[model samples]
Target chain A: MIVDSNLSFLQYCSNDELKTLCDTLTHDNKGEVRLSEQLTDNDVYLRCYPDNMKGMWQEIAAELQRFGGNTFANIFRGGVGASYESILRDVCKKMKVRIPSCSTVEEIEIALLTKYCEETIGSMDIDLLHELSVEIGIKPQSYNKQIVAAAILVALRRGGGKVLAPVIYYIGSNISRILIGRGVYLATAGVLGRAAAALAGPIGWALTAGWLAFDIASPAYRVTVPAVIQVACMRLKHNSHFLTAQCV
Target chain B: MHPADAKAILALKKIPGFNYLVRKYMEYGGESLYRGQNLANHVKVYEDNFPALYRVFKETVTALGIDEPELYVYNDPYINAYTYGETRTFIAISSGAVETLSPDELKGVLAHECGHIVCHHTFYNTLLYSLVELADSFKGIPYMLFGPLVLALQYWSRRSELSADRCATSIVGAQAYQKVLAKLASGMKSFKPNGKELLNQAYEYHDIIEGSLWGKIQQNCQVAFQSHPQLCERAYEVDRWSKSCRYRQSRIRVC
Candidate 1:
């Protein structure tokens, strides 16, 4: 059985195009039926000459061109049957599914499915499960469990992992803020160093040097020292005012 | 440090995975690669090459009490200046900026870039710039995944500008700092900006941004992807600081 796990190319392909390709690949020709596992678990193979492999690739590329145009089919024009081999490798890594180098496409698919299903089920949020159940028109009280189970099975079969949209958004937004925040602290340190140097001469210089050293050496000090200095300087000013009043 | 920067830092520390992100950024070799590319494209400015600019740069660094960084001048048409590099920091100024700005204004620009070094924004800025470039290529990857990271970086980048503006104002006077920003906005083609008018424009801009929600939103959107605030906002910040006791006290008599 020669299975092409070039299914990843279908991500860029439309559903109607995928159906046509699947139908053409699976269609019986002279008792040689090449079935897609996505459509069926039926074990079948195309009986053809080794030299005919190139012809088969040309056929597939021609079929792909109907949907994806020349650029899409151009990727496989080099007679590389495994057009999605790199994408498969990435998916395997992401899903933590291990398949031996010599393993069949069926073996890779099964391993990927098993791992993906396990992860999706294990990490499925209760709210999401409930939402999925409701969205599928299942009664939340009676058919909730069945709906969730069916959805998980479908998701596994469809090769869809848990959507990490929220997590991605949070990280993206916060990372920008964090970087900005870091810049702010750094700027604050510079301001403090300048202000201290101006106000107290040698003592101020000593304080500024200490702050800079700490800021350079430790990220924590960089964050803390600015606020501390701001408050301390304000207090010191207040105290000086009090001292001046007493002298008068 | 500016009060705003202190506030921003405090807000940033609360974010989860920030330390991890910083660690990953530090570990990335993209910055070094970028520096290598820059070294090839730009001319390194030294005492022998650009004596005046180099001297001014040195004076700013000395005044700020920071280690001297390499300076590069690139023949770009855009009137801008930036600093990059991590292990060995470098400041680059566009020829447009030098040609357009007066010596005093150029001093402010150099001082602003130096401020980034003093504030330790150099390394992170390089990392952020690299990440943004990467994000540009990988469009399928949701911005939510790395978008906020870039946004946060832009946020920091913008705030750092404010800090840098303050640094510039302290080194050169408020007038030169304001002129640099005005010149950056309206170029030196035909209009020589009056210092008082530019200052008033900054104040008017401040009022617009502060007075209405629509103005505030416009301001935010305007600076969303920019590394620096609007020239008016920056000019306003510098002008405001110039009048403050802290600015007066910290203002250095530069050579």
Candidate 2:
């Protein structure tokens, strides 16, 4: 498989578009499959490839035209049948979901698709989401999963490169504090904490401000952490659409 | 060795003429020149002279089961320590470090430097030192010629410190190692730094760098020439490792 240098193009694509692209690439024509020369796992490619790639080419072309020339180069460069299971697994891993052992590919796909809606999203309280919405400068009209996901999507997209870092940082700090519990907090009670406390009311604000203050080292975590959060938010948005459609 | 350190070293070795460049530097009075400068400028610690400091060095070497390297103390206000020279290596601690760190923390520092010796890190580390000096001196041809090489070395150098930190933890326990790191983080400026808080600060920095693409890019460019990982990063790594099964196993074996 030819790995594209510009994997960022994948970031621009939606879940449906990615599925469409995957189907087009892996579609078997007259039983002559284009096996990836690089990957040794023939069985993975065989079982995983979408069966109707020959029929999907026109649709993919139309989609690529919409994305323009840069995405055109990216799509062709990424022209190999990647396992849909693997893609789902990557997203699940980024979302920090611990899948049960010995699960089948179908099970994994179901797990990823329903993961946010069935588990964490259902469990999340409206007040927490409301607070998060307010923190990101969004005032939600109703306290629902749909509104929360929309608010997060807007904030994440609007913040983009300039304000995205602090926004993510703030969300992460609050989430961690929630997960771990504030009373159990033993790390941030010193001079730095005191100084940051002087800045504002919410500790997440202080955490974000403190994070922005320092210059740091280059670790792969720099990419992974934000990517994980972004993936979670994007998945939340996708799942909320499903919820809305189900209600309708 | 840390996985990152091993990976970086492999990548660094793949660079053309890198091995040859390191060999040439050693062959052409590079190590000797630095050794001479050390002997001339720094005060050597021994039984006859700085017996108290020498004891800590001896204890660390004994714990790690390596022959004692020369120990030197330089009159620098910066709380710093470094290990250099391959054939006859020496660990140099700044006077500020001697004053700042406690006796146990000082042992942790020594163990870290000795960790480099035990892991056969001195050879490549000496090359890193020389390249840094060369970068400072020549600045044009050498910098352009070995820019990527130096960056790779620095990358390896940062990971190498983590391995050293683990070694130090094995000898002195994780708490002492973390405290030593926190003390180092203070740079002799503050009274006493809370290790947990300092680690939280590191986590915050980690979040910031991870949070934004621009932040990561800015850091990558800035740290391309740095020989060490940031103090908070070191603290974070050691602390995280301390909770690992490997750290527990090493502690048991060392004990």
Candidate 3:
């Protein structure tokens, strides 16, 4: 059985399972198998199939998975060797999302997130829920009376802040400006949040507030805020011992 | 070299001052001028930087029994691949073409450019480039006097592309070759196209060309000065040749 190490398969497989599969592949091929590096989320996974053994891929996957676990179940997630389009379709179906016909990968992701939110928002805290709704740039309380509102925020984040703003603006016409403004606001908040966490003191909070005020005052300053905050946070982190010693 | 190249050469020979112009350009610093510009603008393809693509190029040259031409990749958004220089022929593929095409499709493009080298299009192409440079310098004198020469050269240039298309088809099958044309026609963004549908459209274009005199005239006028044939026409030619006995006999199993 030929062992394939596609993304969906690698995502589920434990390190031990991956090692075993790699060992089996190497042994079967007498060390011809090449494992370049561990697959990362950002990496585009190209399907690997053994040469001249085309039709027997299913049997190979089954046999390999038997040695491993449901790590191989992902190979059968759509079928023996599913196309990315099919996998996206399957995910959409399970989420009960109706994506526009022939939507790109980014659009499908947003749709799935929107559906998930609609199905499960009743249990969320009111203030946290309000923050989430603002983060996604939608009046979750008014527009989406169903479960759709919950998923939108997470979906927007996943789809990318820049991309989701236009999408949200398009969907919620009356609140378009608010949605775009909120997207920018949320993105800045998230960046500042990171800077604050990294700096870790009253001084960090003061610096974050200063940076936020400066960012709000000038659009040009907003571009540099993230970089400036990152550098400032790094410098503070590096000088933590010196500051602590001075205080003592 | 392919059979169609011989026909193109015959057509080129019939054009007045074609050989004289080519010889004159060769005598001038035409080769150095282009080589110097290319050296400045492009990065040479080598095993270290582009191992897999270099392997494909080397294998293709060996299979075709042509001297290995220097290959370079230039950063340009325009999806184009072309060959230049007379004594030292070089093939240059745009970064856009490399990024946009699949490995097999890229190989087909490289093979097509190499085909120009194999079929001796580089010499005439160099001559044409020299004439254009001269026209730029003199500002209308050369163009006015050698207008017909330019037209004839352009005509042969289009025919040369068809010959190169056949050469590419022989190396990487017709499907891959047709995809190069299809991708060039349709930019690398937006909807993915059906290959069979693209091929059928090319065939359908042939009917359009045959059915109306105006369509034929319009198509001819449109590509009158262009170096390459329209994508659909090239696609149709490649598809037709793939099924031909000549292609079957000459086909190399690279994949």
DockQ of each: 0.01, 0.01, 0.01
| CA lDDT scores, all candidates in order | 0.55, 0.59, 0.56
Q: Which stretches of candidate 2 lie over 4 Å from their true place?
A: A1-248, B139-141
Q: Kindly list the per-residue Cα lDDT of model 1 for residues A12-83, writing each as its tens digit.
A: 333333333333333221112222111111111121111123223434433322222233444455423223
lDDT of 3 by residue, A113-212 (tens): 3442333233334543454566555565454433444455455556553434333233222121222223333335466535434433332232233333
Q: How high is the TM-score of chain A in each model?
A: 0.24, 0.26, 0.29
Candidate 2 chain A: 10-residue stretch with minimal lDDT: A31-40
lDDT of 3 by residue, B1-255 (tens): 323444556667766776886877776877877778788989999999988778878888887778888898899997888888778889888888877877777878888888888777888998776677788899968889888888778777888888898888898888777777778887674435565656788778888788899999987898897778888878877776766545666774444
Q: Tell me how large the interface RMSD of candidate 1 is.
A: 35.4
TM-score of predicted chain B versus true chain B for each candidate: 0.89, 0.93, 0.89
lDDT of 1 by residue, B1-255 (tens): 454553454455457978567656666764577678778999898899888888888878888888888788899888888888767888889998877777777888999998888777776688677777676787626455778777877887787788888888899888877777778888774557775566678788889889999999998898898777777777767766776545656764543
Candidate 2 structure quality by residue, lDDT tens digits, B1-255: 554665566666677887897778778887788788889999989888888888888888887888888888999987788887778888999999888778888999899998888767887998878777877787656778877677778888988998898799889987778788877766664556555756888889888899999999987777777888888788887777776556677788788
User: In model 3, where do residues sit more than 4 Å from their true spots?
Assistant: A1-248, B1-5, B133-142, B189-192, B252-255
